[model samples]
Target: MTEEPLPTNASSGVVRVGDTVRRPAGPWTDSVDALLAHLHAVGFHAAPRPLGRDEQGRQVLQFLSGEAGSPDPRWSTTDLGAVGRLLREFHDAAADFTPPPDAVWQTAIPADREDLVVHHDPAPWNLVRRPAGWALIDWDAAGPGSRLWDLAYAAQTAVPLRADRPLAPTLPRLRAVVDGYGLDDAGRAALVPMLHRRVTAMVELLRSGAANGRRPWARIWTEDGPYWQRTADHLAAHTDDWAAALG
Candidate 1:
């Protein structure tokens, strides 16, 4: 039987083979494979399972079927809470994973083995909306990062920090995710700063990728990066307001 070519927003080759997804392997593939195995061993199956390589050397992962979450779904508070909880669980499962001294990652972020591993891009696009719940799909960027680093990135995606909407309306959703994740006062206090750093790094990453002629990155850089920059700016102006929303 022929393998089905899969449509992905990634800037890489992907295909569906039986119950798995086949993608081109990179130098960082082993690290990702180890990361997925760790997630599974720790009972976090919301991510794809690594099933080894195919005949042509493509890395095979369990195919998580379903559409990506709607761009602007009417997310109930419950749904927001669920996402936060899932993310927290993911971070917890990654807690005991011992990072390799020589571990290489797909991204340029130098390995900080001390920090918790992160999904890096656990946005709606990477989530597979199942009947049961949403599951994260891509593991290409999974690597060492802290809870604040990960959660802060998540806030950009889930709380949806953007200049398009007023900060007040989005703060409640931000609070929902933070509360759901059980982030305490200290963690909450650290969030806006992390958001600033995360967005800044992401903008540089996307801009550099585009400059280097990377696709999707090149395609997304103009719009996605700028919006996050605007978010960072808005947050800078109303950091206290955001804190008020949390309280």
Candidate 2:
């Protein structure tokens, strides 16, 4: 049997070949490779070094030697400070470089047209925990978008189902996340509504992607849309309650 590299929540396929990892090839693979290479060259040694392609033409990357998966609520609560700081570090490091010419990136058609470099899918599975620090993995959807895009997504995914902390409790966490990244109030406020928009868009994207024959993407898109919508609806239904939580 082919020894699969430990599975990750990465959007593309990820497999291990000896010590190297082979990821799915896409439009932005080259661009991400170049970005990774540049990052390594400039003293950012935390990220995996891009190693070109595997025998099957898949994009090859060095595996990060540590634990990586979705954030669990038990651990996630304790991890806020560390994760917030780590996220800030990434935004600072990544802000210095331009995306490579051939990097395959995803763009969400959000209502308005404000763009920043967003790691659209910041799922827990895309984060790696190493002795040195937390390493952000999976650069597939890295492109121009909003900081809140990541914040809203992360906040939604990071909450504990039974914690009963209300949306306001998330306000400090959200602010902590934004503050650590050095963004302003305007940017933070701008993020709230987008959360709803993103949730709504996710549902639509999944439905559309599946209808159009993008099967693999369709499945997850379908799953994510409704999942996010439920969260959006919760926020909408309990606006005063959620707003208090956000406060």
C-alpha TM-scores of all predictions: 0.89, 0.79
User: In model 2, which regions exceed 4 Å deviation?
Assistant: 8-12, 76-78, 101-116, 160-172, 221-225, 238-247
Taking the tens digit of each residue's C-alpha lDDT, what string does model 2 give over 1-247?
Answer: 2647556532546777777778878777777777777778777776788898866798888878787755554344446556656665655566667765545555544424434455666656677789998777777666766556676665555543213456555655544544555556566556667656666666776777778867554776655555555666765565444343334
- Best candidate, TM-score-wise? 1
TM-score of candidate 2 to 2 decimals: 0.79
How many steric overlaps does candidate 2 have?
A: 10
Superposed Cα deviation of residue 1, candidate 1 (Å): 3.4
Give the runs in model 1 whose Cα sits over 4 Å from its true position. Answer: 70-73, 100-102, 108-114, 212-216, 223-225
Best by lDDT: 1
